[model samples]
Target: MDNQVEKKKKTNPFLTYFKDLGTAIAKGDVSVKLSMLFMGAGYTFHKQVIKGILVTLIEIAFIIMCIFYAAPNLAKFGTLGTVQFEQVLDPLTLQTTVNDYDNSFTILLNSIIALFLIVCFILFWISNMKSVYRLQVLDNEPESLTKKHINTFREDVRSLFSEKFHLTLLSLPALGVILMNIIPIFVLIAIAFTNYDQAHMPPNALFTWVGVSNFKSLFANSLTVTFGYAFRKILGWTLLWAVLATLTTFIFGILLAMLINSKTTKLPKMWRTLFIVAIAVPQFVTLLLVRYFFGDTGIVNSICSNIGVTEFLKSVGLVSQHLNYIPFLSSEHWAKFMIVMINIWVGVPYQMLIATGVLMNIPSDQIESAKIDGATNFQAFIHITMPYILFIQGPSLITDFVKNINNFNVIYLLTNNAFITPDQKLANSNAKEVDLLVTWLFRLTNDYYNYKMASVIGIIVFVICAVFTILSFTRMISGDREGDYQ
Candidate 1:
């Protein structure tokens, strides 16, 4: 019996249980445990359990405040002249007096919002408490007792915080994105549900919740003013302008860069510097200058009058000289065309600079080999240079396309608000005949004071940008590496 006891002691049941428990704890799934944590399914942390009780107490306090203190006093404030001048405190209990405007919608809405936030906080707190309890239970459970080794939660927390610095640096930009773009955008979206139009301006004229009425009235087929035409027209123009601007700028800029970089071209540096000057000058100044040139009394028309086109066409009896005095800035068709052309002028220089860089980087051996094979300059460019440049600059081109979409400075400065008239009846409020959605949104907020509509338009613009940004990010992150080939 003594010999048997000694042998069994080496293979003890307590030791066996501990080995099993350690294996189970080591192999436990974090995702499964995390799910259990949020659902209040198991106890994990002592601190969280304590916090949960505190939050429950706060919820009770908020309820009491709303019922006994807020609701009754609000009712009295709504009424006229029962010692209305004296501010009431706990009117239901007739406890004390407080202010006359205590029952204002502002106060009521604020209370509702605060209550909503408190409820959210309570829910989150409860979830965290449950998670903590589950984690704690897992940590405390012994290998000897439970037949599994428990993993310490602190190790996991420590590892998470100690992750690589490059990964952690991403949090700063992520936080910036949430604050700058997300918060303002969400606030604007919430504004769309309110009656915060020109009439019910805030501070003085309080805008209240109007629900989906604004959306229905604007978009529903039953409405008298079908904004469909205005929306369609503006959208059509925006798309047409974007396509034309991108293609023309790309084609001409590449052509010009290739031309100046060719061996046959003289004084390449001088010509390059000349183009660079255009890019260096502030765009607004150039656009404003260009706007003056297209004005009724501008230099372009004066030069045309001096040239034979105006008088020559008149002499051949093709048209009257009055056609020469056409308002380039005021006319819709003319303004749109002129803006596109002016964009090409202002845009091409920057593109030229980019193209030149890409062009210079192209392997000379590739070009020489193409030439040795008896390929023309155009063919060499098509096969060797063009592909190389495009591969290198595909991301830049995509960015340029996006820039063209929201290119407001040139359009706005060149045309001013002359083209866009204030038509409150329109969805975008007399968005210029040629105005992009962005400029129109600006006018709505700045000119008409229609913040609600402006916010809606802002949301639309955000959606468009977000879609493009996602596409660009996916392409760049997942696409072929240009530098790898080089």
Candidate 2:
């Protein structure tokens, strides 16, 4: 019997689906067959007046939608329309006439909507057929009409508010997610497969599906070689920045928290308050201030000049005598270093606060035992505190890394006005040495209107972030070593 069950479980899914479907069709009563054809015939035949009416109304609405929207859009979805707007002489008035063109945007949008509706309709049709078969089976069980109809409705309503209450509460949010999140994601994925760039943009120009060409173009052609190079450089920097920023901020934040929590530390609150003040100020304002302070003629350079640091550097050949100002934000390497250092400063406070909370939760017994074992403060931290913190903050660290990969505001706000010589820019790409993939995507869309390239970059960024996050979570969960020390 166990062997037979195992064989059955190994049977092909499609074969099982077909066998079940055939059985449902063959055993269904006449009303069930009619309901399969008309959507509400079984309910009406069973005298389920309200349910039958609602089902029938849904069928009518679906038919109306197919006629008015789905049919036309699905037809045009093939070519995305071929007609072009033209200017011609009007024979009647002997004047110039403009004829309407095929709007590819409308065609694509409507086709997507039609496809979504069709999927929904298919699901509803399946449910309707299944309900009809179930009702027929119930009918054969000799239930009273009141029990089948009125009592059934009452039971459904009661279940909705009781056993199925979560479903009822989630229905609106599910609908919102479908409309907003799911639809937009589908649209973005679809756009990545098309030539929907500046030259091929809407009504005036019709863009068609060029499946995988946009992706190929990113690495294949001379025109995009520069973009490919820029992508490689930016991606390298992004990974480096994420790792360095995450580690620097995390380490310093932990150390700061430890200092504040130390009995030997004086005026801990004052030190914490000073650090926390960075977080209290608006990030944009802070970034802007930092940018100016490090600019060529800004306070830092001015102070260096006033204190003769600039002259000293020139004498030592550290800076050229011809250039009187330090190019902190202007030079690529300098700008990158400054941005990372500034990020560490701005990001450490939040991590410090988190570390403070996490530190309190560490077992004092473990630390005291280590001390009694003649372990120094460093040894106690390395063995006990570090493991505890890592176990608790492992997932949070991964999240912070992902956030820093897409940390656009820091890079953009600080370097937006900083002058990068044209020689330093990517040959044909709208990317600077300091721009991350996210910042490059922003420049592509906002500055250059290169939607195709932007969409491709966006997809790549999402894939990279998703892969890292998934791998990190899998390691954290599957390793199951969180409580090993405990």
Candidate 3:
């Protein structure tokens, strides 16, 4: 058993796949060999006429697409098009006629898409060869050679609806994933390696691959663009925000649920319903309304000003004495505080419902025993309630942390026109002090048209989230928690 385990661990599955490929090519019959050069040729040899026709049509369509759609872009992909955009005068009309220009972005995009399609085509061709080889082998068998035993196109269609139904169901979803998710992700990564900034705006200007220059710039400081400094600050704040946001919501939600559910509490149903009302309203509307409430000259400021609260704050040096209104969403510390507080307001109710459901399902005996042992309510809640909630919602907590890391709406909407970065380094880097990685990426792409740096930040965000999730989940499942829980 030990030897077998060692052998299994030593084996590389990818190498095994190539070994199988070699066997299929060398040992396959004549029809299979034909399939290497011509798709569906083996199907035709096996007399599957309808299937062969369909497969052949697919191959022909791909050939046409390569010629018309992929080739022109791919030809110029290396230099991302050399033709400069120009305008000319028509002597007769005396109108400026624009010359045909090669768009750099278009060339890069089309080339990546073409390469992806070629890879998919290669995989499909390999599968076709393997399939045809099996059919050719069956042809020599005494039973398989019989007409009654031979597989028909109609039978294959029937099988797709029966034993192979999953394939039919998954086909469209797989295509959608490739088009929407896979292709765009490839483009994003590819853009990280190039200089696709505002200066290289397509049609008028050209951007070329700068190799790892973007990545290097991201980690190193510059006088004009202090990206390394901005990244370190934004990354630190992003992580801190995610941790605080997730835990605050989760912990407060649990406490809220406990408070409402407690026998000492009055009108629990009314309280729960009130909390649900927050959930009923659209989040963006609520966020926008709150943005106004906390604005420089908004109602909150007016109330504070009227009550001498603004003066009190000014005396304490919390608000600037030079300014009349307190900078709730404008100042860095103040904005970060308000964002999290408002998020707790917006986010806690949903979590409360989740925590409420989980708390009810906790083993009653554990809580009863803790009480019997003279543990106070708070102690029992901490030792029993907290651990149980953490165990049940471990995956959810991880998801919440990741979600908060990329929570763009709250950060963007709250600070849209209100918040301005006071720090010169952050402002120069196209970042705000309170900006999360996701919001910074959005600002770089949407506001500044700095796609190169945005893509690099995007990749960083992906890596950070991916690494945390993998490590957290690995630790969660590797524990002997069933013993304790049961």
Candidate 4:
């Protein structure tokens, strides 16, 4: 009975089909059996060609819909949102405004495209069904998978590899990367071409493709504000911040870590734990608390008043008479400075922890040998310790630099709405003083609802991060060729 059961299992065409599927996937090609089946049927080939034509037609139609119908309608929506209803004198003019019903051609084109996609998708579905049906027919035929001849083949494959566990483990992380990260990024990248501005907020109002106009306006010519000022200023500051923040944090973090690990210092664990406490707390909570302390009526100002720095500033007339309380978090330049300093406070602890771990891995013998040669502490650090730590931890340091560039919560929470200026002349509509590109992008989408620009900014951020990551990887593998570290 057992031998007969093994023979029946060996002849299972379901199992054979799976084995073939594995081989096809490994070779990065569709199953030859399925391809042959499609090609074998003249009707199937005709339908596939038709499906391709329909897909191309639908894409062209989608683009045309956006340019002719949706763009004009959306412009009307923007104009209406900007103007008061009572301001327009001509009833006919007002009727043609965004407040009027959506353009019928836009609706018709969209509906047609939607229906076209649905039909083509159904055709693909039908193709899959037909293939499955054919496979099942093959499975049932005695000549295809005979009941008594295939036991040895199954046993031979089982001895090779545990294919089930191998595939399951390999696919889990890849599936997560595709679904969670890659898909959202692709969708956001696509959104950049659309007219998803404040006026045409999605679900309530539809947005359409606007070509490269968003990038053009953002980079060079903008009707809303002077073209290059906002972009250049924000970009310059972002670059400056990335450099200063990383350098300041790295220099200080490494210095602190070295100091704590110094032979002269006592209670290393206690000092390390103290710094750890800063990083141990949620950063948002720490940032919010710091923001409040620096607010108009906050303790920092009250303490400054007691210390007579406020009186000194008042006497010097640095602060205007109208301004009674110091606006640490309010003034743009001051806010930028304060955010950087607060970043140092929040940032250094983690670097210190990382440096400490990396420092421990540095050979004690290297330092001992340097000290025996009558080298001072600083000389020993420079000649013996620093290079080893930097080599191992260079990647992390670059990552920290990238992290600080997009460090939203620290900048956003600390500065709050203070960076926002109501004057249209100030920025790319609704920008704040201390807003990083990420925070600015978030404000565009979340507050102002200018999703097209938000998407544009998102692409810019991606490019910046991608560039930095590539550079970091290059540096990590190649080392600092300048010979400064060595």
lDDT of each: 0.66, 0.84, 0.89, 0.67
Q: Candidate 4 residues 318-437, lDDT tens each? A: 655677677788877677788788888987887788888888888899888889989998888887778887778778777877887798888788876554554464465566656678
lDDT of 2 by residue, 1-486 (tens): 999987886887667655655666788888878777788888877656667778989999999999999898788887887887677998999999777678887888888988998999987887677767777776676666555443355676788999989989999999999889888777778788888878987777888889898788776536535766777888899999999889999999999899898999899889888889978999989999999999999999999999998899889876767989777888777687888899988998999999999999999998998899999999999999999999989888998899999999999999987857354337478888888899889989898888888989889988989987996888677878778899
lDDT of 2 at 411: 92
**What residue runs in model 1 are displaced by over 4 Å at the alpha carbon?**
1-175, 211-213, 216-226, 311-324, 417-428, 480-486
- In model 2, residue pairs whose N, Cα or C atoms come closer than 3 Å (at least 3 residues apart or on different chains), thus clashing, are none
Candidate 2 residue 348 Cα shift, in angstroms, is 0.5
Q: For every model shown, what is its TM-score relative to the native structure?
A: 0.67, 0.88, 0.93, 0.67
Instruction: Highest TM-score: give the candidate number.
Output: 3
Ranking by lDDT: 3, 2, 4, 1
In candidate 4, clashing pairs total 2
Please say which candidate is ahead in lDDT: 1 or 2: 2
For model 3, which pairs clash?
none
Please list the Cα RMSD from the true structure of every candidate, rounded to 1 decimal place.
Answer: 11.3, 4.2, 3.4, 12.1
**TM-score of candidate 4 to 2 decimals:** 0.67
- Using lDDT as the measure, name the better of candidate 1 and candidate 3: 3
Supply the TM-score for candidate 1.
0.67
The reply for model 4, stretches above 4 Å from the true place, is: 1-34, 38-161, 221-223, 313-322, 422-424, 474-486
Model 3 over residues 1-486: C-alpha lDDT tens digits? 999977875787776666666777898877778778777788898888788888888899999989998998899999998888998989999999887899999999999999988888988887777778777777767664353555799999999999999999999999999899988889999999999999999989989999999999998997986999999999999999999999999989998999898989899889999999997998889889999999999999999999999999999999877989889998998899999999899889989899889988999899999899999999998899889988889887898899999999899999988999889988999899889999999989999999999999999898988987886778677874788857
| Each model's total of backbone clashes | 18, 0, 0, 2
Indicate whether candidate 2 or candidate 3 has the larger TM-score: 3
